[model samples]
Target: MDLPAKTKNISVILQKPKYAGNIGAAARAAKNMGISNLVVAGSAKYDQEEIKKRSTHLAADVVEKIKYVDDIRAALDKFSYIVGTTARKGAARGPFFTPRTIAEKITAVSQNNKVALMFGPEDTGLTNDELRYCHAVVVIPSSRKFTSLNLSHAVMIMCYEILLASLPACAEIPPKLARSSELEDMYEQIKTVLTRIGFLNPQNPDYWMTHIRRLFNRTSLLARDVKIIRGICRQIQWYNNQKNT
Candidate 1:
């Protein structure tokens, strides 16, 4: 039977995963639970063939579309809500939720915006530096000495629980596509205009394009919005040209 579209905001992000097998199995978990997107952060393994071999014929969709990112902050900060999965004890306040509670937090955020659920490296779990990016840290309820779980297994267990819990109360979530090409075109026009007006230095622009790309992606832009933006850019650029020459 074909699975329904995922309605929750939870997206599992693997940080610098070492083994292709682990990524493959993790994809299977997300796929089995009907999670569509799996994001990988850092200079990591995201090869299709390797993941396919490890997936064992499951989660082919996730394995095929896996995205790799060099910037951890860009990956984590893009989403409004975030959760860090780690079994380590903490001195300060943190909700030590069961797998069910982890699902709950995901649900709570799903009502509004996107979420990033992060898992750490293989040998060690999430580092303190990475954990700080998360709004809350979740500790899977387990034995004290052997509380830790394998990277992929932990994601699978959590994703499965979330998917199971949400099935009963699931509603129809319409498709949200990122047809961002129009936005990209508008940015190009904006850059041209800014350069013409001397607002943006073309010769020695300090990563301006990169920042603009990030900013544009951050906004929930639609195709129609891009058309309007393009027109505005043209008008402004024309006005600037007329004023000067």
Candidate 2:
């Protein structure tokens, strides 16, 4: 199969999945869509036989090359872009994108940045804390009565959309963005500075930082942008220290 070039930069991450079979099936889905990287994040170990059984011989390579990480955030830290999948919706959970729209966005993002398509565990989707790591969240539109989807099924739907989007001629590639690790570091600095300055509530600073995160995520910040923001934080801290002395 002549796969899309951008697809090579995309990875599918399964966070805290309970079933080995779902992991295997998700690998098969990834292979079908030309995505080679599959990461399993969490501490639980699964039976290899059960995993290989569901992946079958066709996706044996994918299972063989699966990357395991004890922490989802650590796995996500290396990627320049992350898209999370969820079924639930609330004021705090969204600004959600449809699979197709996010796929189109991913194609462009993958042109210059490593992109991760993150799916939460089957029973309970990604927690609010986990979703904070995502630059964008996608919700598969399903019947209102029962919105949840099986883990592998959700992976396949998302992978399919991404594959479809990547089939067309390439558009202008965007500038490379800062990695998640850098953005995370800057967020921590921003939180501290804001709290010290009394701009953010000291007791629950994360709640206020969620809005700040969204603002920066929408901006598609580059490496220089992160440095600029962090420099501002440092200057603020220095001035406050001088005044105290």
Every model's TM-score:
0.63, 0.97
lDDT, candidate 2, at 145: 93
- The list of candidate 1 runs beyond 4 A from truth reads 1-8, 45-47, 170-245
Runs in model 2 deviating more than 4 A are none
Report lDDT per candidate.
Answer: 0.67, 0.90
| Tens-digit per-residue lDDT, 125-172, candidate 1 | 788667655555678777777876878788878777676566554454
lDDT of 2 by residue, 11-84 (tens): 99999999999999999988888887999999999999999999999999999999999999888988998999
